[model samples]
Target chain A: MTHALAAKGPTASRPKPAEFIAFAVLAALLAVAPFALYPFFLATALCFALFASAFNLLVGYAGLLSFGHALFFGGAAYIAAHVAKVWGWPPELTLLAATAFVGLLGLVAGALSIRRQGIYFSMITLALAQMGYFVALQVPFTHGEDGIQGVPRGKLFGLIPLGDDRVMYYFVLVVFLCGLLAIYRIVHSPFGSVLKAIRENEPRAISLGYSVDSYKLAAFGLSAALAGLAGGTKALVTQSATLTDMHWSMSGEVILMVLLGGMGTMTGPVIGAIFVVAIPEVLNRIGGPDFAQWMTVIQGAIFVICVLAFRRGLIGEIAARLRRTL
Target chain B: MIPLLGISTQALFGQLLLGLINGAFYAMLSLGLAVIFGMLNIVNFAHGALYMVGAFAAWFLLTYFHIGYWPALILAPLGVALFGMVIERTMLKRLAGLDHIYGLLLTFGLALIIQGVFQNQFGASGQPYPLPEQLKGGTNLGFMYLPTYRAWAVVFSLCVCLFTWFMIEKTRLGSVLRAATENPELTRAFGINVPRLITLTYGFGVGLAALAGVLAAPIYQVRPLMGADFIIVVFAVVVIGGMGSILGAIGAGFMLGIVEGLTKVFYPQAANIVVFVIMVAVLLVKPTGLFGKKL
Candidate 1:
């Protein structure tokens, strides 16, 4: 296990000029995506894109396969929805509040879980997330199974109304881009290098006088905050926050997106999220009544195929072939 | 109806019995997981799915071939074990010596496929498996009325768990299995067929899960998602116990089940999350798990 992990080395490499071009092209495509597609669908996909990026930050960059990340993602959604519907906060404030709360939640969860490594880490995080799910289920504000429904999109920054689908779509896109950019910068920064070092060889990092646990916890918190931002934005777009977001399966879905996108690559998560989010929507549109079943089976097949043959993921493979870092 | 801590003795004892039954399943499932993890170095995420398949196989046997519970108990696990061995041969074999997470992901995918297919076929509702004729009635044990099937399940699962522990810890083959787990290469150099050993171990572990499923079918509603719901809690049990020792898994399984049962009696709202809470506490205090050796 140690050798296999160390062999992965650091995929986070020095930034090249072509990477900028790819980023710009991605931004331009996303900016015009809503014009061609359904704005609601685009917004949802963008939310998932951000969610997957946040997940990749921990799994890809930090080498932490946190199986319970939905705690922050869905936990933030509930908080965002509650603040929006009950506290009547502005959209920005709601998102900020939820993101902050989940960031702290991540810190605590990370602190407890980082002591264990590998499969133990995954199981601990999963148990904690399942605990969070139970809290969401029993807590009164979540309104039990019905969830906090009809959440007001509210005005952005107290001035710009975001009720319209096109306006909300743009809001989500901006947030997605900012979140993705934040993740990209973090990946390239000195801290990200340290994280990669820790991932590659924890004992060696410790020998080098690095506080590996602190670094891991910091990365976990940051990843969690970004996931919360995505979740908060999703609540506003969808106009509800449900238990589905916090479910363990939601955690699995996010992991799937990151894996499908190419775990360590900058553009992979977004591409992966789009595939995952869009596949079900498309299936629902075209398939018969049993499509939901097929959707799960197909998702499972993708997981198996990705692990078996496409471990580098879509972007990772392309980058390898092109001999360039994506 | 003697009052104990402001609750009826009957209710308390009844919940305790239910907890014991839940603990029985947890013990069996986690025991299988520990054995497999020791041998495979891969967490079989498909465990719960295979357990569900075991129950379904029993259902199919009864519905199609008019087989009874006793035969299903023996045959279902055997069938599932064969399926598992084949999976190990064709799929899991390719992943040997790679990162363990890939095994987890692949098995997770298998689980989703199995669960999704069954759900599509059976819908979300549960199919009831009748209790065997002899185990239908209840015995009044003074404090509470105990269902005969539940008692049998607890006793039977405990026996199975202990027998597995005995097989892996006391027998000569068990020593070889442990040696392989400790160092596969060294054991292989000793002229043991380690790969075949691994395949059989996986099959045996999966068969244990199927046995649990058969035990649970009569008590629970035998729903498609039954294992899914139970697996997370069992994961909590594994974490709490640390999966290092077979006894730890069994002990923690029953203990947590009783704790959850007691919580239900005292504070019904917390019944669901209590095990998870204990898991967090355990992780915080002893990250290596109570019985786990230091990493």
Candidate 2:
């Protein structure tokens, strides 16, 4: 058992230079893409990619599926928006406040949810997030349906003016890259190997003297913090936060993003996030207003097909085929 | 002079009655989930959608076929069970050897389809299902007035929940189910048809949800989105009760409902979230849940 566990550890801890190079190329493309594609659209995709990658950290690597991650993402957005708009904090400080607040919330939620495994864990997280939704709906500070609107983007470190859409797009790209790197580092860390051990066999890990619950809770917090990073950035870019962000459907959309990309693969979630977010926009441009709501139908179809036919996901399948050829 | 720190007796009784009514649906739905999970080891995420279908089925029967409430109650669950059987046979059967998450995903997809189609046909707005004339009136207790239909719903659901509990905990067939839940292969070797039992178990669970939906139609309007949020709340209830015990589920449901009602009386803002709060507290205190066996 120890031999088997030890063998699994090195693979997770070693980071491939190829993966980092691929990310760098992807980052370069994204950084330059606003010149060709719409900057706002590019920003939106970056925000969602960050969110999906954070979500992927939990579901893909640790094997703990949280269906309520929108709470962290959207809840932190509300916090960051409120702090920036009301407290007049610098953009960086507000982002920090939001990330910390979300990380704490994730700790509490993760600690509670890790008590149950599999579907029960998913349900508990979802229910707790719904609870957060109810609180947001009734709370006075959220501004009810309108949310905190016209949130000032404020200066990055009170220096670089993010007022320009192009500048803001670059700012969002940088944040997304930073968050993605953090996720990649976590997934390849020694702690990450322990998490994978717990995921593969909780009982054995527990029996082997590892504190399984703590590892799971840590992973959850890391995932939530990264999700908060995305949400906080998005709130700044969009200049508002609303109830829609905290909704369960948002949670479902994130799951779809991760599933479509490839769970456990570094490149898969980024690709998944781009496709899931951009597809609806593309469809709207082509099909017009009447077909906008059809996005849900399309998303639903993708989720079904992914689960039924392509469980390994886009990147995982490609990697497997390449390996077979090699 | 009225007592301090005491609500009027009438108001208290009324809230308690309302609590019992909400608890009835909770008991029925959670029981169905427990049964399905026990036998099939799969959580039916579509349980709520199936329940919504039951309410919609009843509405369709009334509007389209001119069927009354009694006939609709019987037909709605039967229709849902038939639908569940079809799902088990076609889609769910394919997922037998996969991880439990795949089963959940499949059901979730089915739920979206069912809810989406219904949403397309009937907009988000709710349609009223008239209370049957026989059950339209109220019974005047000295402390509070109880609507006859609400009373019947509570009593009838309690009976159904207990009947199910007894069947699973006491009967020979239930013993086989319990045995199968522990060791499907061993039970199969003993000549039990495990796969058929799984389909029927799913059907039974779906049927229970449909029955609850029929019961709920008169209280809550028949709406496409009705089951969506309720399912999430029921999930909290299941977590709090520790899905391992049927009696625990029923008890926790009524207990949490009363707590929720009390929250409404004191702090209405927290009522919607009180059950979740309790769930968190339960997790902190006893992670395995009050009656749940250790994982």
Candidate 3:
């Protein structure tokens, strides 16, 4: 709550009552979504939505495009899965530990990557993440090829068992809401303004006495921590952490979600995440991996079209049209 | 531990030769990358895919039209270069004046489409392209048994790399290209056709990748994923070489390939990752790359 109040967003205005009401409506909708939809799918999409939302905070709000977010998301998933399965840690402890570890990882990765700007920066992050992917494959604790399977969901706290699917979904939902709201507050906060200033013009920001690199690093660490949060929650929900999670392709998928949903908008990435995840799933239900291969072509086409034609994205364009933040 | 010191001179030299062959491809691909970047200011992310396309083009020509390796070598690159031209004029040209990242993203998408379509049509398992009859044999050297094709590949690619260097660095036409690359608007004012030069440069760079692909087809099994595997290493090579210097890109490619080969000999597990490790280290010391000018 403090972070949210602090971030008030890129704008430094008073807390508008409408913003609170809109967030409440969004929460109510997501809370009731599982009853109308598949609880398992909702749980899965929530993980990705959180991932994309966190990614948006960096790319959309902070003006840094990280092409290697899978380093955080998949890395944390593996760590959380390992701890839950082997160490028998409770859900909260595993999530906290995994997220914190990735935050540290992000700090190191971000520090090195911020040395380069623009395209070079993206490549640096990508190369480092690729290294992390190899680590996931070669490391013993990750179990190499098979990944850490049969991860125990464990209890939410000390008392409430989260073994039931419905209970687990609700737990995931609560975590998702916290992560989303935190991002919102971060974007609206004073720090977010500094980040925006850096994004808009770094030299000017530097001239104004802002430590641009430190701000960028802070934003990266925050983004990576939130991505870790999503990934850790996912491991608990799925009871597995496989290598595909860390693949460069998964990184691309998150970028796609952010681009499709609208980079800077509040709700764009979540909507985009749901769309990408859901479409593939619906196709999987009808056909197999062959059908999914076609999805790659479609995705590629979307990327080309989006860059050529629709840069604003669905939610972003809508928000612009309505003259109100979604 | 197995006696690392006891590894034979024959074994070491053999790996070195293999490394040189890999370096030949690396040199050719990175040279293409550097040239394209020089002209376009956009890294051609689909370069590896084009290389794969070149190999496939060769395969298709041989199977359907009875076009053998020698003829396919010349023809396949030409065909792929034409395709690259179309991509530039229609797609990549639109990305001009935008952030370099947009160009990167656009080409990345094209690569996915191309690789995906090929993978869909032909399974991921490799397809063998046999050595042409003349190049089928090998000669036993005191140091190593040099396959006729392997020696030819190393010498041939080195010549091509050098020739490309001469064309870009030495020739009168190259001076024009250099001028255009330096300042397009100024070059245009000097009565040069900058737009046409940009298009041709992209095609030529892509053709170089295809040429390497044709050279690689018989050596590495022609697979849909052949380029995907090497492209990352090439990116590492690019990062180390720095994008600004053509000579640097080629030099780094062969140099890193040897380094990778030596790593395989010393610490086999580290071979796959050694290039990336070096990249990080280089970045720490010289983020601008070894031969790179100030950005």
Winning model by TM-score: 1
lDDT of 2 at A164: 90
Encode model 2's per-residue lDDT on B1-295: one tens digit a residue: 2332677766666777777878888888998998998877778889999999999999999999999999988999999999999888887888877878877776777777788778877889999999999999998876678899989999999999999989999999899998999999999999999999988988999999999999999989999989989889888889888888889999988787778777777777888999999889888899887878775
Superposed by TM-score, candidate 2 places the C-alpha of residue A106 at a distance from the truth, in angstroms, of 1.3
Off by over 4 Å in 3: A1-22, A285-289, B1-4
Pairs that clash in candidate 3: A7-A188, A7-A189, A8-A188, A8-A189, A9-A187, A9-A188, A9-A189
Q: What is the TM-score of candidate 3?
A: 0.95
Model 2 chain A weakest 10-residue run by lDDT: A1-10
- Least accurate 10 contiguous residues by lDDT in model 1 chain A: A1-10
Q: For candidate 2, report its TM-score.
A: 0.95
- State which candidate, 2 or 3, has the greater lDDT: 2
How do the predictions measure up, each by TM-score?
A: 0.97, 0.95, 0.95
Q: Stretches of candidate 2 above 4 Å error?
A: A1-12, A324-326, B1-6
User: What DockQ number belongs to candidate 2?
Assistant: 0.63
Q: Against the hidden true structure, what lDDT does model 2 obtain?
A: 0.87
> Number of clashing residue pairs in every model?
0, 0, 7
Write one digit per residue (lDDT tens) for candidate 3, span B1-295.
Answer: 2234788666777688778888888889988988888888888878989999999999999989999999998999999999999999999999889877778778877887888888888879888898999998899776567789988988999999999889988999999999998999999999999999999999999999999999999988899878875777888788788878878888898898888888888788888888889988988999888887766
Candidate 1 vs candidate 3, DockQ winner: 1
